[model samples]
Target: MADVTPNVSLVATPEAVSFLQNCQLPVQLNAMTGNPAHYDYDAEINTAITNLQGKAKESATLVARLTQDEVRTSPLKHQEASKLAGRLVELAEGTQRLLTSKAKGYMDASSDFMGKTFTPNPQREGYYLRAADWISREAKNGEGNGYKAIREAVTEDPDFAVAIYNTSHRLLGLPKEHAMDFAEKAVKAFAPAALDYIEKSQRLDELAKRYPAFIAQVRSSYFSPFELAKVRTYVEMPS
Candidate 1:
């Protein structure tokens, strides 16, 4: 008989909270630089921002559902996590689009003259830096307690990776850099955490040899978009 895998959805459980507490999910104003690129920066950034906004809403919507209906509460404790995740996403995304545009280097004077300038709405790199700053304030303010928490395993999602990388750098209080060197380093540090989970995808092995660290990593991501908020917090925080 094919064994059924238990659903590993994101929930606002103590375990999940504990995991998130190990992370830093807030976006800060300094983590992004809206400098214009030779590429179609605005178009790319728009697509990226849209996606992040959706993610924010998705978490918020789920949390709303769980809270509005008490009947839906017992099987899972996703309430606290969902609410916080939604808030965090919203805060980070909002700051990127709204506040970061005003930062210096957000626009390219050369591109502007040529009508090829970046969109102040949400420049790719700029947005990240701004989002990181916003998140930092929230993180430092103990938003981690109220709307501060996480679990979505940081991965290669373009927008998310940018967020994680930016957040990691921001939490460390690094002056944001133009190159992706820092973000890449952040991703590399966490890549091993998701490797085991990827391996499991090839063959679902309930009793596969498990390393303690591997198990911890797998659990954070196995549930994915649904179980990620808690883990995101961990990645954003320092070691």
Candidate 2:
């Protein structure tokens, strides 16, 4: 199990509060229908917004933890570190899409004023519930490998790598040219462990100290091997 920071908080921003307010149902819809199975659209949308905000904030904190010295330097933590980080990234990005996208804005507006109840897209609610459960379970267990969805994404999903790289660069607060050059240096320095050639348990910390971009990448990606491979140039294990 990787290092755990159990007090992670999923804070909802004021903007999120206002945005969710715009999505509230009018008084007429508050009454429960005679049917026992009647679904509450207002409750559903509010819950989705609330859950997404909390999860995204928690993911940011966990991603920050994944970049800590202990986790980054410990060979034992590397694989689990990547799995947790990748899943958080997937979760964060999905939350961002559902919360901030223009399509969501349009949809919410229609739903709020135009009498629409359920979203045509079931995947939003589906992923939210599934991911919320998975995260809750993993938070308690500290066994990071249980989330197979992100593991598969980090390995086979190019988009995952792309998103991590792009987001990481910005998160690092680096200029584009400097960020690129630094990533190249990180690729050379961390390639062995990333390729599973040498554990280089201490070496990861040494290199991270030298290359701050490496820390940013790990903070953003937990040093996902696929993201490492996708960093401008591909790196492979030497046979």
**Which candidate number maximizes TM-score?**
2
* Every model: Cα RMSD to truth: 25.2, 30.8
What candidate 1 gets wrong by more than 4 Å, as runs, is 1-41, 68-103, 106-239
Instruction: Write down the lDDT of every candidate, Cα atoms only.
Output: 0.37, 0.35
The estimated TM-scores of all candidates read 0.23, 0.24
Q: Write the per-residue lDDT of candidate 2 for residues 90-158, one digit (tens) a residue.
A: 543443343334334434453343222212234454543443343334334322553344333323433
**Considering every candidate listed, which one attains the maximal lDDT?**
1
lDDT of 1 at 239: 81
Tens-digit lDDT track for model 1 on 190-235?
Answer: 4433333333322212211222332353244222344334444443
Q: Which stretches of candidate 2 lie over 4 Å from their true place?
A: 1-46, 56-73, 100-221, 224-239
Model 1: residue 44 alpha-carbon error in angstroms: 2.8
**Weakest lDDT window of 10 consecutive positions for candidate 2:** 28-37
**Candidate 1 local lDDT, residue 193:** 31
